[model samples]
Target: MMESQQEPKVTIPPLIPLEYSNRMMLKTILECGDDQIGLFGKTVVVGGWVKSSKEVKREPVAAALKPPTAAEAFPPSPGRKELSCVEVVQSRIPFFKKIIRVFGVSSDSYPGVREKFEPVPKPPPPPPSKFFLQISDASSISSLMVVIDSAVVPVSAGHVLPTGTCILAQGVLEKSSSHGKQTIELKVEKILHIGTVEPDTYPLSRKRLPLDSLRDYPHIRPRTTTVASITRICDTLDFAAHTFLHNHGFLHVQVPIITTIDSEGFSEKFQVTTSKKWGLGSGSDADVRHETVKAEQHIEARDKSKLGTGVKPEVKEDFFGRQSYLSVSGRLHLESYACALGNVYSFGPRFRAEKTGSIKQVAEMWVVEVEIAFSQLEDSMKCAEDCFKFLCKWILDHCPHDMKFVTKRIDKTIVHRLEYMMSISYERISYREAVDILRKVTDKTFETKLRWGVPLTAEHLSYLADDHYKRPVIIYDYPKAVKPFYVRLNDDGKTVAAFDMVVPKMGTVITGSQSEERLDMLSARMKEFDLSRDQYEWYQDLRKHGTVKHSGFRLGFDLMVLLMTTGLTDVRDVVPFPRTHGKANN
Candidate 1:
């Protein structure tokens, strides 16, 4: 009985060789040193799509091979034979080849494969004929290629597929000797539609559409190569800005968008209210009924006039018992936070109601407001320079592809320009010096003549950025009469410790200054500016309790985008759903 006991037989399958597996082979290829593969006499396999395909017949030559020329032989040749009939394959295609096997002479030689064929895989039924194929599969690396049946319907304006469609394709891959690279040509044995259609979708496609055309479709523009690339760059810049501050121990503060005061008193603000007429009335049933009656009466009176009239009948009762406006800037609030929390920054949308026809302005845009306690204008200027340099370097390093595309298409000198700006130390000069420089440039191109006390115009700033400094210039110590009341008065009494950082294309990207921390001086300045003391009681309370010398700056986020990518013509082009005066499409 013991001898009758027997074990079941087991069979083990043979292991697949690493060289035959696609992933293993791809790893090997990636690990291979550059130039290790000869230009000829090497067998290489590449996976991509057929950008274009052609068939031609020629008589096969029977002549013997000739000796290499001196030009070709100067570089000691790695022993390999060159292949004939080089082909080109565009890498822009998506999901070129999920899997491919190419055997050819000379890994560097193109059209090396004497014959090309793709192994067909069983694929699902084709989608509707209307459905276009968009392939995106990774062989081993993260590279994805997309191949569309361009012959069926050439991708053009209004006919391109919405972005975000997934597709599968079968194709042949070969090395292109003419182009000096490898490519995949989708013989397209079978195209499989693996996903449902998305309404608005796109990844990389043809050239960037104009900003004017994209304005009509803000939500979908991001799907395009240009917009996507810019978005990614903007995101990186934002990250760099925050990181530059955070790494230096600055607290990230989220300031309120709705506030009672305008930090930049020069610009008009969008009013926010809780009154029934302004759309934020809610209370008890009885109060609601009363509000409804008042609203109806007001509406009846208003309807008696023009249909598009913006005025509303004045109500005696206060809404929310206080007046508020969409903050034009968060600098004031951030100053208080900075005094309390050391150094702080606020990043958020700021709204303005000014009808600026100038190309430099937008009604609603994001801003980066930074305030540092115990810091002066000089310290703030240094911080700004460091922040700008950090942003440029971060974008170049983190968003190489996007930056490259933007530099090539949007602005040819963007990278070089930004690099030069970062490498060179910023020039610092007094406002008086800036005024003198502007006075010297008396050309017809200048829109306005420069005056000593007048606020510097965009033309003047442009001259400083483009001509005078050749880089970012920090112009400080402005005339106190033209500056905000918050700015600290300099020893000269006629000037304030304020500065504006002007870049080549964008002027006044950042404006900041040391605050008047001395209560007596601030009170006197507030009186001189004709500002109501009651309006800033809380702000003054800081001085009453514990006020420290501080300096801060406000950077228009849209302006930063324009300066970074150099594509956007106006601030509106950079912001999504822009709310410029006379145009509130969102």
Candidate 2:
């Protein structure tokens, strides 16, 4: 009865363990060291881009006195014991796996046998028996050496692997016979995948491409050592920031990317427009008529308003109603959440349209905006400092491999600078004190003409961090008139309780301030700054209903990455798709 029962219709497919399902990273085997004798004879599938390849020619099987004979090709079928070298060679075998030995009568390999017959033409030195390839997957600076035999996977003599040719192959790791080469190498038995490259047009074919030149080929530049290393470092920094914020009991609130209020007050911003742009994409006659009617209606309404408008239209035609823009900062929206929810933070993209040509400046950037309720300037500074330190330590601990790679190639002092920041306490000084140091310096001349009310330039901040203090310097108490309207005015009434943290090689990375919690004072400041009361009435409501002293900071994410990588001078180098003035070549 049991034998008559039918088996289940569905059969489970063979399960592949995660570690073996995909090709092993070169880093895994490389970290095992040059001599991985313990791992020898183990089979692994690995993939990487071809960094270089060379064909090694060996000594021909026959001696110099006579050429290889046709009889050496093999013994007659009747008496043949095994395939001879001549036969294997003629069979297009690139490697001699075993010694040729025949039991039956065969042509003598000895010179005397050749003397018994007319000499035959010696085949030009046999095609290189082995192709040596060095490939890297950008996992590490060290590349894995792969040995391929044409006998196992036949390739023509002219076949060459150009740089950037990606390949995946299954092979066995074994001890290398070469004296000075890597102690262990992959002996490829089968090639699973191959992405050949055209040497003529492959952009990254050179051994070392300048960082500037890499901008032209952003799509493929991650294969480069410096760019790849920087990319990994940036990735770690991003995660570290989130982890640090989460560990500290801070709530991450994603603010609107598009907003009506200009968070930075006077900074230029990208106007957010509806995607229904006219005259860009082709459309049917009905679609055109629909768009034309909408435009006509808007123009007619504007014309009607110009002459005799009694009441305003309920909602504007813009995407968000009225004017909207890509947010320059998330602080304003995030502050609302902090006031209601205690400690809150936001980290995301921010767009700026200032026409400055500084290397570190980009049209689009990332910022970590933090707002702490009932906190003062001191608390804000401490929170930012801790966050920065935690991020540096995180990268140092989790990204040692990438750090070492960048240190060796880009900036040698980067590691020490990071260690310094982690161990030593940051230096804190008032804006007045920083100005005194700048004026006292006779070595470098000032470009802005040093003044108490003027905003500090990159040169000034760099001088304080890189040269004078030789560490991170937090400058606080800037002139209230020059700062944003929200920064709390100090007791003196002339300066606001604002601060900026400047680091060596990376000028001002963090900006923090104690926000004005008093409704009366905030409204006055906003009015004095010529801000429209109607536009910022909602912001004022935070103070009117229930306001507590709130402090926060905006840390430039790209600048933090630049700080971690000592070699990079520009934010563009760290950002994968840098959007700058007139250039966004993705």
lDDT for each residue of candidate 2 in 65-114, tens digit (9 for 90 to 100): 55655565333567557865555554542222122234343344443433
Ten-residue region with minimum lDDT total, candidate 2: 93-102
Per-residue C-alpha lDDT of model 1 across residues 167-233, encoded as one tens digit per residue: 3443332232233233322233334333334343432233456777777677656555565566667
| The candidate that achieves the highest TM-score relative to the unseen native structure | 2
Point out the worst 10-residue segment of candidate 1 by lDDT.
Answer: 48-57
lDDT of 1 at 395: 72
Error of 1 at 59 (Å): 25
Candidate 2 local lDDT, residue 283: 88
Candidate 2 deviant stretches above 4 angstroms: 1-21, 33-35, 58-128, 156-160, 179-181, 275-315
